[model samples]
Every structure is written in C-alpha cells, then in structure tokens.
Target: MTWFREGEELDDEDIVSKVDYTTSKLLIRKASLSDVGTYTCKFESEDGHKVEAEFVLYIYKGPSFHDTTIYHEFLEGADGVVLCMVTGQPAVDVQWLKDKEPIPSTHRSQLTIRSVVRADYGEYVCTAKNKIAESSATFMLHVFEPPEVFISGDQHSVNVGERVAVSCNVTGYPQPDLHWLNKQNGQELDMAGRIHVLDGLLEIKDVIPADGGLYSCMAVSTSGNASRDVSIHTQPGPPHYLTVTPGPTSVLFTLKTFPINGGTPIKSFVLQWRKNAIEKWEETIVAASDVLAITDLRPYTKYTVRMAALNNVGRGQFSIENTVRTEGKREPDSPAISTDQAKVEGNSFSVPLEQSDNGGSPLLHLNVKYKEEAEKSEWHKMQLPSDAKSVNLKDLTFGSDYHLEVEAVNSNGSSIPATFNFTVPEQPVSSRMTKGTVAGIVMLIFLVVFLAVDATCCYRNRCGLLMAVAGKLSRWKDPGLKKVEEGEGTTNGDVTLKAISKPRRSIQQSGVQTISKEAGHLTEVTCDKAPLTKNEKLHPTTDA
Candidate 1:
C-alpha cells in the first residue's frame, strides 16, 4: 500500500500503510496543501498478476481573517464599511450580525451601512463558512453626534435687588461641557461671584442696572461647540394704581405700588394737592409705603391730588390727577321700619319705639306726624322725648285708612322719615256679655227680697225657709263635736245640746259644758248629771 502526491510515491515516515487479505489502508497525520495529489493502492495475487486503483486527494482549508477584532468610527448620518479579509481553498459564504443579531448582507466578508444612528453602535460579527469549517470576525461600531444648544427665554426684565435665572439645554452623543459668557465681550463669566453658572443655568443675584446685557450660553464637546444668546433690559416707569377716600374733614390717599423701578430702589414720594383749580398747590414729601391722610380740610370741598416717586435716578413723572370731594354735613340715615312694626290695635296705631341715627349729633327730639289717607287734611303733629319707647294714637276713626311718619332730629337736620300705612278696624255691636250683666242684676234684686222675707218669718214664728235650712245644716255638723252624751232635739222651741268630752274641733285634755238658748233666754247647765226635763226652766249657772 502507498499514498502518492502527483503520481509520486510519498515516503515521509509519518505515513503508515497496512495490507490485509482483501483490503489496503493508508493513514497520514497532519496533511498539508503541499501533500495534495493523486494516490494509488496496489493489490497482488499469489501469482505474478497485479491490480491497481487510484484516487485524487485534494487538501481543504477553512476560512480565516486578517484581524480577529476591529473598531470603526463614524459620525451620525455617515456611511460605514467593515471588511473581513479571508483566505481559503474553496469559496466562502459570508453573513453579517449586529449585536449578536443577524443582518442580511449582499457582499461576502463585508458589512455596509448607508446611514448610521446611535442604535448602530456596539459589537458586530462577520461570519464566513466553507465546505470545511466556519469562522467569524468582530467589529465595534461607534457613532458620534455634534452638540446642539437650546436656550430657555429670549429676553428678560428685572428689578433692583432681585434674583434672575436663565437656563439652556444641550444634546449630543457625548456629554457636553457648558459655559456662560458675556456676549458684549467674549469672556467667560466668573463662577465664584453673584453672577455664575450652575448645572447649565445662568443665575444673577442682587441685580443692578449694569448687569443688563446680552448673555451667551455655550456647549462644547469633541464633535462640536454650540451657543445661544439672551438679552436683558432695565428701565424705570411712573407710579401706578392710586386711590383716594374722602371724609367730612379729611382725604386719605392710597398709593398701591410701582411695578418697574428699573434697577433703582425707591426711597420716598411727593404728594401735591390743590383745593380747587384756582388755588395754589400744597405739596408734602412722605416716606415710601404710606397711606397718607391730609386733615383739617373744610367740609363740602373739592380737591385734586397727584403723586410722584423718588428713586436713585430722581423723581419720575407725576401720575394722573385724581379729583376727590370731601363729604358735606349729612342727614342721618333712614330708620329701619316696616308696616308690620307699627301694629294695629282696635281704633289705634301702636308704633313700637326703635332708636334711629342722630346724624352724628346730639338728638333734639323725635317728631311724629299722622293723617287719614282718604281726607285732604293737614297732618296732626306730636313731639316726644328722644328716648321715648313708644307712640300711641287713639280715638282713630274706624274703617278709615291712616298714614304715620316718624323721624329723629339733630342739630344738623332731621333724618329721613319712616312711614307706615294701616286701616282702623270697624267697631263691633254690643256683646252678649252686656245683656248677661242686666239679667244678672234683676235676678239679684229678687233674691234679696226673698231673703228679707225669710229672715222676718224666722224671727217671729221660729220657722221659715231659712230655719229649715239651718236645722238641716246643724244635723250635718262635724261628727268630731258629737257628744259627751247624746240627747234628742225637741220640735217645740228647745235645742238640747250634748255636753261631751269631745269639742267641735279635736283639742286634747278638754271638758264639756252645755249651753241652750230658750225662747227669750240663753242658759248654761250641767248635762253630766241628767237630761233636762221637758219645758223645765234651767237656771243660768254663772260658775258652771
């Protein structure tokens, strides 16, 4: 057995061959391109007869790259190309991958991008394969973008001793460095002063008029630098929002505020007033922040008021004049009264007292005026004390409509009159109670005559209507006085009273003595011994 190259026998000791009864085998270790050729195997019988077979051995190699890993850089929106240099015996098939994900490619061993974005950055693989083996190459793509800047506000207006801030936003692939500059001079602003930059913002504290200028904000990066500008202005304006209140003797001036003071602080104000257009002007200087009061003014007068503010730049223009009139001596307000407050009694109007305003002066008196509504007559007038509690008008004509007016007077004037209207109710007919009184008097006279006759009959004959009533009443006397001893009463002109230990009322430790009244005599007798004999005269016992 033999292995051959280009029909020449291979004699390297590393090649081994083995012959068996029906087959021949050859083994080669670490074969190379140089060993690619035609090879033959020989077989012989026991006789001198020979058979030969041949084969063409072609050596194959897998793909390889010049660089295993590479880095590529591109700006945004630019094209990018990565090439894989490979060597192999057979043709190689190529495929592309981005971040470990497959990407279809038209060219073998090459990857192309028409437009690159930030998403295109990161690891990329170029895979190649042949009949023998597969290999890959790696590329790291980086996309860059230039810096762009955006400022917040275009302009600003500030007051004196105020704080102001301006901000800007920057965008770029890599973070940008920010700077604030004075646009008037291309110099960077100080970082350790009242005006400085913090976190992409430009700030100014304790602002002055000089601080008003064009400011620039810049952002810098490896790709590019970007800038934007802003402007600030300062100016002083006139005072605003003035109000005036008038009283009887004075005028109050209210100066609300001034909005734009430029960059100067206001210290004071000057107020000028005139009694009228013909009179000379009087001016007073007051500290800032005041509700000024000018007193001692004559009542019922008109005046013109104007004011100006004082700042570092001097006084500004005067505000428009405000015309005000002081109040005159005024009549008191109307008293709170209603028709219901003046109640209507029979044939009269009862007006309940309610104190009214006295026009800010001591009250002189309260005057009441009244009249019938349907009659063309002069009103009846009445006067009452200032503190009177009520007003009553009586003897008013029934079924007549009436009107009443009430007012309070002071030294200044009379207050407004409060009026009420009501109608007097009609008088009713004589009542049944009067008739009942006449009937009751006639019955009383007849009862008195009957009582006189009954008394005369009882005195003369010892029996009459009143005598029967007396007997019946005596039988029903209080049982507690019943008896020391019980005795029967006689029908003839005698009354036998029992002398008992019990008295008419329940009193303790008491004795009883009997007293009987006869036809012409009252006698005291002892009933404890025995009952009196019928018609027997019992002598009066003075000591009994």
Candidate 2:
C-alpha cells in the first residue's frame, strides 16, 4: 500500500519489470480516480520469490443540498390548495403525508381539502427522498369558522304599535360583515327607517299591517356566507261581544262595536251560526255598523254563534263564538206522575217517578201525602224534596199501615195527586238470630254424648286396670318384693291387700243395699257400721 498527494494519481508511473523476466508479458488492470489513495499487489513464487505494485484513486464532487421549496399561507376554506417545488442533485421522489397517513395520487387528489372545517386545521408534510437522503416540509393549515345569523328577540307574536327587532350574528377569521334585506324588495337596505338597522339589529318600530313582509339577515365571511329569514305580521285587537234579542224563529244580535285602535275602520261583518246537529254553517252578511238579525231560525233550538270583521285589506280573523238558544214562550203542560211500591231507606221511601214534556221545562217542585187508613180524614200533606221524585214517611211507627200519593209541579201549576198504596208492617225478628248459636248448641249436645261414652268406658277400664295391678302384685317374685321397706314410712306387706280390700267391700255394701230394697226391708247403713277404708276410698262421703 502507498499514500499519494493531491493530483498525484494523474501523473503516477507504471511499474517496471525486471530484465531477467525473460521477455514474459505483465498484466496491468486499469484503475480510475474513484479508486484513489491506496492499492497493493504482491506475487510469491514457490521458492519464496516476491514481486509488488501500488496505485491511488480519486473522484470529483457534485451538488450536496436540495432546493425543495414549499408554498405557504393558504386562505382558509379554499379547498386546502397547496404547492410543493423541489430541486435536487438527482431528481428525488415526491410524497405527501397528512397527519402521518400516506395520501394517494388520483384525479381528485391534489393538495386541496374538500369541505374543510375547523377540525381540518393540522400539519401537512411534503417529502422529497432518494436512496441516500430524505427531507420534508410541513405547512400548518388553518380553518376559519363560517359566518351565521342570529335573531335578536323572539318574534312569534307581536302587538300593533310594538317594535320588533332582528339581527345577523357572524364570526370569521377576518370578522364577517352583516347585511339586512327585505326579501320582498330584492335589494340591500342601505339604512333603517321603517326597518332600522343599528349594530346587527333590524328594528321595525310601531309595527303596522304595512310593515309585514319577509325579513332576511345575511352574514358574509372570508370563509363563507349564511342567511336566515322570518315573516312579520300585525296582530289583531281584543274581541267584541255580540248579543241576540229574540223573535219567533228569528233573533236580533247586537255587537258592541268599537274601532280598531291601531288600524283602519272595519268595512263588513260576517255572522255565522249552526243549527243543532247540523255540520255546515249558515252565514249572514251585514254592514260592519249594522246589528245582525237572523230570521227563520228553528224554535227552541241551540245555535253556536261567531262573527268576524273585514277591512280594505281582508277580513280580520273571526271572534270566538258565543252560543245562544231561541226562546219559545209556551208554558209547560202538566207532568203526569206514575208511582210504585217504595223501598224504605232510613227516614225516606225511595219511589220511581217519571214525568215527561216536549218543551224543555224543569220540574220546579213536588209534594207527597199519606193516609193512615181507608177511613182517614184527609191526605197528610208534606212538601217533598225539590228534586225528589219520591217521598219518605219519616214519622210513621213500625207495624203501621199507610198509603202514599205524589203530585208534580212546574211553573204553571201542580198536577193531580197520583195515588199508590203500600202496607208498612213490622219486620220479622227471627232474622236477628245468628247461625253461630245453633252451631254452638249442636256442638254442646255432641260433646255431652262424647264425654258420657268416654266416662263409661273409662269406668269399665278402671276396674280392669285395678284387677291387673292386683294380679301383677300377687304374682311378684320374692326378690322384687324384698325391695319394700319394713317400718314407719315403709309400705307394709298388707298395703297391697288393704288397698284391694276396699273395692271388694264396696261390692258387698252395694249388695246389701240392693237386697234390703228387694225384700221390702227398710235398712239404713249406719256411718259407724260402714267399712272405714271403703267409706274413705270409695266416694269419700261428706256430711253435706
């Protein structure tokens, strides 16, 4: 290996061969400057002979830094348009990444964003790269808010002579401009007179019918524009009341007329009503000043009434309807009363009474009376409940008999009393007894029989038990009997026999009493002669 100076590789000499080389040809490979500075070649013979050669190589330099340029400051909402220009030693491949995601190149694919919104503000990168090096440029995108409109006050319903105001509210990066327009005019409103534009509000003062129109507010921004529209109307006045005076089938209705406060005088009035059960309306036309008198109406019928006023523009909306019925002067005919057996509810007798009339007249009053007997002097008259169809005999005593009658009354006069009779009698008292008493009595009889049978069986059983206990003692082994004590508190050897002795003596005493009675001998067993143990243990007889 050998070291060479600057420009030395261009003048370096070729290697010389030895003269004893015997005219042998030497092979030298061409080396360019790219293979610079150091090189070594050595040959070794079989007997340790050696040969050597050295060379240097160098190359020229090219451009280093890239001229990839990026464009900036795009207007917001301009479809995200952008430009990237690049210059490099070797033309590099250009690629785009938005938020770290590769962007595909298609016809719609440009550096532009579609439907750009506030959330679309972010960093976008353009990369120029090759096998050796890579570089990227980041452009920060900014999205401005679009413009919009806002209404000032709620304008659903506005009264006449009252002011209504509307406004346009907007926002943008460059602060949007507001405009007002009457869509009916199709032109921009330069100033406010009828419709005043101050700040963002379009105020309509002392609103009149003529002030009604389509109002629009528009907002323009560098990003976009927005608009909204609302309609205005003049409100009607408070309503008037109409009165109807009666004639046969016709009635005259008088309206309390008044001029519209903030409006023109009414020109015409419309009167409408409907007959009972009728679906369609009957209209009457009259001068706005004239009172309405409808003719040929149904007698004694209900009618729903309504009216409206008209001016030069059109009809003001109708007033709320007030219902009225025609008058028929006929008096109510006598109401016939029909009566039946009445149920006596406490202090009252409820009776079904029916009365009917073609004309609508309420029964004003009724009266009732009763007779104690067929020979009673006169009907016992009592004014009945005003609404009662029946009368009650509150003062009558139980088991008493009485006949009842009722009379109907209206505005004209009372009807003849209709008579119906019923005999009031004492209610049966047996109904007061409860089933529990009979059940208790039956259960008592059954219990007595059951106890008598059980006692007799228990008596017979006692005799057998006593005999068994005696037999067991008599058959006891001597070893078991030895357990008995001998003296004082001990049971004596005669205790069993003595306990058994009384029962046998009782049988004998009963035999003596029976024998005495059969033989016609009146023999009394004296207390002194009675067996002491038997008398003590048997019934334990007492002096009483």
Which candidate's lDDT is highest?
Answer: 1
Q: After superposition, how far is residue 321 of candidate 1 from its true place, in Å?
A: 24
Estimated TM-score for each candidate? 0.35, 0.30
lDDT of 1 by residue, 416-472 (tens): 888888898776655334878789989999999998998887665445688667655
The parts of candidate 1 lying over 4 Å away from their true place are: 1-57, 67-69, 159-161, 236-544
- Model 1: how far is 484 from its true place, Å? 99
Model 2 lDDT, full chain set? 0.57
Cα lDDT of model 2 by residue, 462-506, tens digit: 333333454346435333333432233443233331122244445
Model 2 ranges off by over 4 Å: 1-83, 87-115, 119-146, 152-155, 172-174, 186-194, 221-225, 236-544
In angstroms, give how far residue 333 of model 1 lies from its true place: 76
C-alpha lDDT (0 to 100) for residue 46 of candidate 1: 77
